[model samples]
Target: MFPFPPSLPPVATESAEDLAEQSEIEYGTLEGGSTMAFFRDSKIETYQKMWRYMESKRPSVFVPTIEEGVKRVLEGNYAFLMESTMLDYTIQRNCNLTQVGGLLNSNSYGIATPIGSPWRDKISLAILELQEKGIIQMLYSKWWKNTGDVCNRDEKNKDSKANALGVENIG
Candidate 1:
């Protein structure tokens, strides 16, 4: 287990292009393949997109697990491209790891069933019922928001404050 942040930032991440640019600079070469982590054989099209994009500049190092990604990131000079859920979960559990940029894409969570399975419709209906009854929302809040272990952010003055003048912020 890792220590959580005392207070969360107002924004989870910046623009994806910004993250890629910043990461490229960090690794000291935009043309040489930098190491980035991704779940092996991912079904996500965005994963393939990122790989292709990075590969055009430099070949990337893809890892199997989120933990491996986190490890590479903590070791410095690396970036991890993953789903927002996993990114958030990892960031919540580790103080040292933070999401760098905004979502590159959006996806919906789904319950999978074998094609043509008779139970699919029943399961889908059950899920819909739970969602309509607010059971799904309640469970989500309980696990992701009300866990009491994740950090809290104060969003009151988020938009009214002046941007801090800093080297990092300038780029």
Candidate 2:
């Protein structure tokens, strides 16, 4: 989530390089813009590299917590790159913050069962059925998307479409 008052026009991107090269916006406009970003300060080398990239060319963009990053963003002129699940949760609760792109990367999770357990196949089949019928997606929309205390922004569909998912390394 990058900070832009709900009033301003969108400046969305999925690339960290784009944000830094283009400037998260010198101060809400691209004409004479410069980098305006925040890093997650992670131990992972990729994250460190990303942070260093921003710091080397731009002002430091590292923040220790989501609250700090979000606060910085809400103040205006910043991009908070982070793990998407948490960031997306925060976005759901606020109208001021919105994701501007598609997945920078992705991972999969699965249910676990005892080895050769009968329940394993049953659960997997059930999950697949739910997926094929779109029930899981519908449930996600109902709970994660709609069940939030957001501002009165546009109440549109809130699915992560396949575009630029934004700079994952930073957000």
Candidate 3:
């Protein structure tokens, strides 16, 4: 399960050259070997500086509700979700696949959940409402596509498909 709120790793104080050398030694790079040699020769402070620089590039994350979710989405607060595992997992659990699919299909707004549980239902309904607004679209699954149904029918169809293929008679 993803944590409710994600925590990023702290920036290390060590230098890039040191980090590179450590990475090289830990991976066992010989004197002339290609891989580790390059980083091993770099200054440790260089690596540390690079780490801090990258951390500084990250945008602050915010949690918003139905009233605020749309606004935040429009503002790009959920942009990190594109590459963040924690954010993705949280979205997956709180928002069903259909809702997320709809958001992806829509071009206007972004998606973000509120800080607590009270907003879960509201967020979900808001996504649906957003779809109605033409700002999003809730895509149905393959099964739903063919039959206009959302419930899984795998088990119901299993016996027929198996019998037709003669799998039931197999030893």
C-alpha lDDT score of every prediction, in listed order: 0.50, 0.55, 0.29
* Residue-by-residue lDDT tens digits, candidate 1, 19-51: 333434221112221224331233444445555
> How close to the true structure is residue 106 of candidate 3, measured as C-alpha lDDT?
13
lDDT of 1: 0.50
What tens digits encode model 3's per-residue C-alpha lDDT throughout 30-102? Answer: 2232222332343444434433432343222322233233233333312111212322333433322111111
Per-candidate RMSD, Å: 8.9, 8.4, 21.3
Please give the TM-score that candidate 3 achieves against the real structure: 0.16
lDDT of 2 by residue, 1-171 (tens): 244344433555444344545544432211112212223334545445555565554444555566777776787776665556666677778766766544444546798888989999899999999999999989977877777564455547443322353344534
Ranking by TM-score: 2, 1, 3
Each prediction's number of clashing residue pairs? 4, 13, 11
Query: Per-residue error at 33 for model 3, in Å?
Result: 36
> For residue 98, what is the lDDT in candidate 1?
52
TM-score of each: 0.57, 0.59, 0.16
